[model samples]
Target: MSKVVLITGGSSGIGKSVGEFLTQKDFIVYGTSRNPENYKNSKFSILQLDVKKNDTIKKAVNAIIASEGKLDVLINNAGAGITGPIEEIPESEIKANFDTNFFGPINVIKAVLPQMRKQQSGLIINITSIAGYMGLPYRGVYSASKGALELLTEAFRMELKGFNVSMTNVAPGDFATNIAAGRYHAPLIDDSPYIKPYGDTLKLMDKHVDSGSNPKLMAETIYKIINAKNPKGHYKVGEFMQKFSIVLKRILPDKIYEKLLMNHYKL
Candidate 1:
């Protein structure tokens, strides 16, 4: 039987791209959107789900299990982006980002694990970010949230090993997507000390996304991981330098790496 897949936040961006590609490859794909009605023309079915809402997560997962008898894979792709100096961002905004990017994925995973454990086979792929590998200047909160997911995946892989359920993190760099439009940007206050620096970094970040790699690249990468007999705990997909930065972090002196990041962001 073709593997059944559920992709969260599948209305657009990497999630939509992955869902469409998997559908073409003959996999049973169900994509989730808060407003499923908006994506009636999607190549795959779009289920109503809001990652931040546990009720919706359970509803969507249960619906898939009820229909398919099994859910072979889950792409935890539902996430929001936030950008601003950490100090200036509101406490509520920070918690909200974590709720969506971090806790949301965890709840979805919780909903799927029992079914996956019963089957004794399943793959859970968490879509993380290259920025998660290292804290970027103005993108601190976004980085922290994704980075936390990365670590959570590491721990989950070990815990799920006995159940034959596999989990992994696929961290992608800037990808040309609608993410910028959706991201929460702390207002640029004219009198704030970070005004010029934060504003410049924000523009550069937007430029990177505008010129980023095609989301199709991420889709192809996800497909490969899904087919693997045993996917690794983590996979980084992006331009060479973006992936290499992770390696640099591993080998470089702390201060030196920090300097490189500061230089790159022109902070």
Candidate 2:
């Protein structure tokens, strides 16, 4: 039997791309979506899931286990993109952001662990973001959420080593996806202080996203990671520039790095 893989938020965007890639590669793929009816792809099973709700996550995982008897890999790809000025974002919005982007994956990971533990070997791939490393100017909450997940991935990697379960955090830079379509915009108040600066920075961010790296490349990277004998801790996907920026962040002065971000965002 082929390896069984489950991916969350697989109705569209990078999740869908990865699911299709895995399915084509002959993995028994189960992709999740809030509304499975929206997906018409017969290549892989479309399971109903809402990462925001723990009960829904439990249900999805239970169903997968019941059907497959074993799960070989889990791709925590479901996430929400929250954008706008930090000051303008409400506390509720911030909580919601973490609930979906951070704890959502947590809930799913917890659900799958028991099954993977019994199997004694499994792989968990958390789809983080480049913004996770360097906090973005306008999307502070989103950055914080992913940053938190990156740390979780690192800590879990060490903890899961005993069970032979591997954890890899994929911090992808700008990738071509329709993430903006579902992105939440913080409510800007009347006479907002961040209006002009945010407008300029967000416009630049949009341009970069529009011309970002291919999602197919991300799928390919994930495919390789899933097939490897011993996957590494973290993988950063994007162009050479994106990888270089990560390298620069390590060696460059803090002030210089901030300046680079400022120049890039024109803030």
Candidate 3:
């Protein structure tokens, strides 16, 4: 029997790429979008699911189970990005980002665990970000939210082990996607102290995304992980420098790492 895979935020970007790839590979793929009606032409089925809303998560999971009997894999790819000076960003916006990036994935996992536990075999792959590995200028909130999810996956792997449900985190660097357009940006206040530095950093971030790797790279990586008999606890997919940055953080002193980041961002 073909494995039934569920990918959140699958209407476009990395999730859509992964869903389409898996479908081509003969997997029963289902992708979730807040507004499913808009994606009528998707290669895989698009279900209605808003990660921030627990009710919708349950309904989507139940609908998938009803149709497919079991969900063999879950790609927790639904996430929202936020960028601004930490001081300038509203508290509400910070919480909202966490709701989608951190709490949202947790809730979806909670809803799927029972079914996965019952099956005695399942895999859950979380789509985290390379930014999550460190605190970047103007993107602090986004970093914290995704970082929290990365840690959550580490803990979840151990908890789910006895139940035969595997969990892992796949952190991707800048990919050419609509995420930059969809992400929330605190207004660039003309009078704010962070205007110049924040503005410059924001432009650099967008440029990186515009020139980033293809989303298909992420799709291929996801496919490889799914086929692996024993997927590692975490995987990073991105430019050599992006992946190496994580290593540099570990080896370099805190102050030195911070300095390197500051120099890189031209801050």
Candidate 4:
């Protein structure tokens, strides 16, 4: 029997690439998205799923199970990027970021655990970001969301071991995707007055994201991990600057790193 893999946010970007790659490997791919129609291809089954909605999640799972009988892999790749200083960000926007980035994946894990446990073997792959490892200016909320996900991934990996369900966190540094489109929706308040500095840092990050690692490469890495018999718990896929950023965070002093970040953004 071919392996069955389900990917969230599979309509585009890395999710779509992963779906295509896995399909070539003979896995029956069920890719979920809020607007499945936006990405219709012969490689995978496109299903409607809004990670934030429980009813949608249940429906997607039932549909896939009815057809595949078992799910071998689950990729929680649906997430958004929110930018701006912590103080300036509205409470609702912050909550929404967490809902999509961290909590939504948590919900998916919960919804899929029963089926995974019943099978006694399944892989849960989370598409975290380089922000998961290092804190960055103007990305406080986004970084925090990924950090929460990292903690959850580590804890859940150990907890799920007894059930033979494994979790892997794919933390990519920077990727060429439309994630920035979501950042524009961040709430703006004139009273906060932190926009100037926040905007400078965010602009720099956005520029880099536009020219960063190819989503296809990240997708291929994801496909490799999913098919591996023993996949690492964390896979770091980042290009030059992203990799350097992580290295700097490790080698540089806290004061030095702070100064560097401030200078880079002219904060």
Report the CA-based lDDT of candidate 2 relative to the real structure.
0.90
Scored against the true structure, residue 43 in model 3 reaches a CA lDDT of 96
**Backbone clashes in model 3, listed as residue pairs:** none
C-alpha lDDT score of every prediction, in listed order: 0.96, 0.90, 0.95, 0.85
Position 133, candidate 1: lDDT: 90
Candidate 1's displacement at residue 36, Å, is 0.7
TM, every model: 0.99, 0.97, 0.99, 0.93
Order the numbered candidates by lDDT, best leading: 1, 3, 2, 4
Candidate 4 positional error at 118, Å: 1.1
Better of 2 and 4 by lDDT: 2
Q: Which model is ahead, 3 or 4, in terms of lDDT?
A: 3
Overall local distance difference test of candidate 1: 0.96
Colliding residue pairs in candidate 1: none
Looking at candidate 2, the ten consecutive residues that score lowest on lDDT are 181-190
lDDT of 4 by residue, 122-151 (tens): 999999988877677778788899988988
Candidate 2, residues 1-267: lDDT per residue as tens digits? 899999999878899899889889999999999999877754688999999888889999999899989999999999999889887788898999999999999999999999999999999999999889888799899999999999999999999999989999998998878987688876555698888888777777778889988899989999999989999988999888887888889999999999998888888
- CA RMSD per model (angstroms): 0.6, 1.1, 0.6, 1.8
